[model samples]
Target: MSKIGFYIANLVKRVQNYSRFKNVFLQRLPQRFHGAARLLFYHTFTADEKKLATEIESFRSRIPALTTDKEIYSYTSPHSNTFQTDEAGNALPGEYVGSAAEAHMKTGSSTFNGILLRRIVAGAGVKKILELGTNTGFSGSYFLSVPGTELVTIEGSDALCAIAKQNMDRFSDKHRIMNMLFDEAITQLLAEAETFDCVFIDGQHEQKATLHYTQRVLPMLKPGALIVHDDIYWSEDMHQGWQHMVQDPQFSETVDLFYKGICVVGNGSGTKAHYDIGEYLPRPEIFRKNW
Candidate 1:
């Protein structure tokens, strides 16, 4: 079966197995769009996905600081997390062998969203950060690392928001917080009449829409600020999105590591620079020696 076909078949099987899949949203979604429904189903799950949900939730629960530690770093711990080194202990490669996990735990991202976020947060000396796509509060949580770095993160799902809220309680008193859908968030942000030094765009993986968000929010960024897009290699569309943004002839650099993409917007003339910050952990040796 095709990818979307498999998803629909599995969904039907799930609905047959459990009443949970027969919800108003699920029924209405497919009825609204027979072809596009699979996109939603692709990310969401049927009854079988409960296993992943359980695993991911369990992993979230184990973390001491759910908001920052687990959400931002891609489940790799800072102290135990190793780095790349040359044959003479200089520098060569890296990997996230420390903690490999999926979004909901079936399969996690190998890229290290955590490390880059920390480095940039500290390096930029940004006093405030606005994060898009605050999934489980992972990336947004990283804002806690910078002393007094205020955070305004947005997430779409109410369930995810509740889970993020629970996780964020650990660091609730530390940073500013805002969890809502992207559309509602744009309205809220505009109404607040506020702007930030940095904005991390990691929302829905759609290429054109993501680019639209980047463009719409450009004026909200600081003159020498930073805006990073995750999973540029996630799809051809995303790759195209990355390419389209850089084509404006306004950027100084663009970087791509297979897992993530970073774009920098700054300088007096508004040039752009993008980079793939290699491997976040650079510990391929662990898998070579162990796994």
Candidate 2:
């Protein structure tokens, strides 16, 4: 899109977000206190949040040089044109041929999302995290930034997994990298009777797969555990899957941040609610980096 078009679209989104914010928070405050409340809600950031923001900014700045332009083969989803298949047309494990620089640029989460993930982990005090996609380990590093956090990240591509292992090693040694399909890794975890404080679903952006994996992992989540669904708006089907999750009885609360969706399991609130706070949140530094 052209720069003007992008600006216009963003302006429209901001207007809609303002309306939602007003309904969700401002309207509930006393009329005279609304201005003060809004200011406090958006302007204030905890010390941890600031620290995470700085860490991600510094980390992302070094990614390009670290990855360089080295060519590599990463896993390809069946939905992609490059996915491998047998002569009989049966699907087989496939590799996506691309340079490390291209893979990171195309697959890694943005700096804004990285900071958001880290802030959530730190705020929720997440110790054990199960990440479905360990694409180059960029986002996984953020999850591990919080002290004492141990991650079990799964990636289908061996090459990508190896890179992720190296990246995650920089943060902590308390992580396990599984270079296998999502279902396979999840099965192993379930068989081991493993449970997690948080689960990040960042792979298989298809509706059926998303729902299926989420249901399969339900038994492996601890009480009040968080289930984060990335790229919720990637496609109509993905959005539908996210909607289904929001309506599911297991989650006591759901939050839609446009780019990412979050669900809390059995929060014991005796009520279920969904919040759309993507545009409502402060993001003045989202585009600070040139990349």
| Alpha-carbon RMSD of each model | 20.9, 6.9
lDDT of 1 by residue, 37-65 (tens): 23222333435334433433454644343
Q: 23-106 in candidate 2: lDDT tens per residue?
A: 765554324233223432343445765676566445444555654447656654323233343574323443455665544645
Model 2 residue 49 CA deviation in Å: 6.1
- Candidates in order, TM-scores: namely 0.56, 0.73
Q: How many residue pairs clash in each candidate?
A: 22, 0
Clashing pairs in 2: none
lDDT computed for candidate 1: 0.50
